[model samples]
Target: MNKVHYLNSHVEKFREDIKITIDVENIGDLTHYCNLHIENKKVTKIFTECFHKKETYKDLIKKLPDTVERLGLFYLTTVYWIAYTCHYHNDKFDEAMGHCLDSIDMDVPLLNSPHFCKKVYYYLNPIDEVKC
Candidate 1:
């Protein structure tokens, strides 16, 4: 079994209606996985696993439309985190920027929009040197 190293994980109340829990882990060899659960009037859970050797960034980005369809306006933070992790580990900043722009195009307010905006800005202008 591949050992998992968590990059980040947290649980928090999102807005007044939803609570979100997210776990992002690197399951060895640059493979990344995210497990996210959101609870409001109903329960929604999603698991996305990407293997670096087997998947290209384009493949990862292609899943966004389906993800947005499934999750609607909720839990995009975890998606952004997964994108950031994929880029950071693979040095694929340009693809990361594309992922961020696509997420923004969904045009819903994220639980932490400012934080996500900062990440997008850093991807556009790395001279600012903000830590993700």
Candidate 2:
């Protein structure tokens, strides 16, 4: 993100904010002291709105990249959230499966075993038999 804009917006009173945040100058000196504000609060808030099958939820998820999907322990959480959103929430089965298998690739375990995603939910969901 553009740090100069952040420095101008958040820490308006401090030059240190400008130097460390924008220029990355004397970086080691402010390693622990400088806290750069990226203004990501809005993005974080949007993702925190849980899962979505369509409408606003789908629109919001489209804004994020798949790299973000691989972060945190959200792989399983996101998969199930998608399932619930499609099956019970929005009745958008095809879209949910698309997200579960493709976008999130919730199936890929960054761990030793990649089958982790299927074994947990996709593999056992009786609903998969329910005709798309």
Q: Best-fitting candidate, measured by lDDT?
A: 1
lDDT of 1 by residue, 74-101 (tens): 3333444444455445566445545766
Query: How many clashes would you count in candidate 2?
Result: 0
Per-candidate count of clashing residue pairs (backbone under 3 Å):
0, 0
Give the distance in Å from residue 45's predicted Cα in candidate 2 to where it truly belongs.
1.4
**Per-prediction TM-score to the true structure, in the order listed:** 0.25, 0.24
| Candidate 1 TM-score, true structure as reference | 0.25
Show the lowest summed lDDT stretch of 10 residues, model 1. Answer: 38-47
Tens digit of per-residue lDDT, candidate 2, span 53-126: 23343455465545443322223333434434544545466555555456435532222232453343433333
> What lDDT does model 2 reach?
0.38
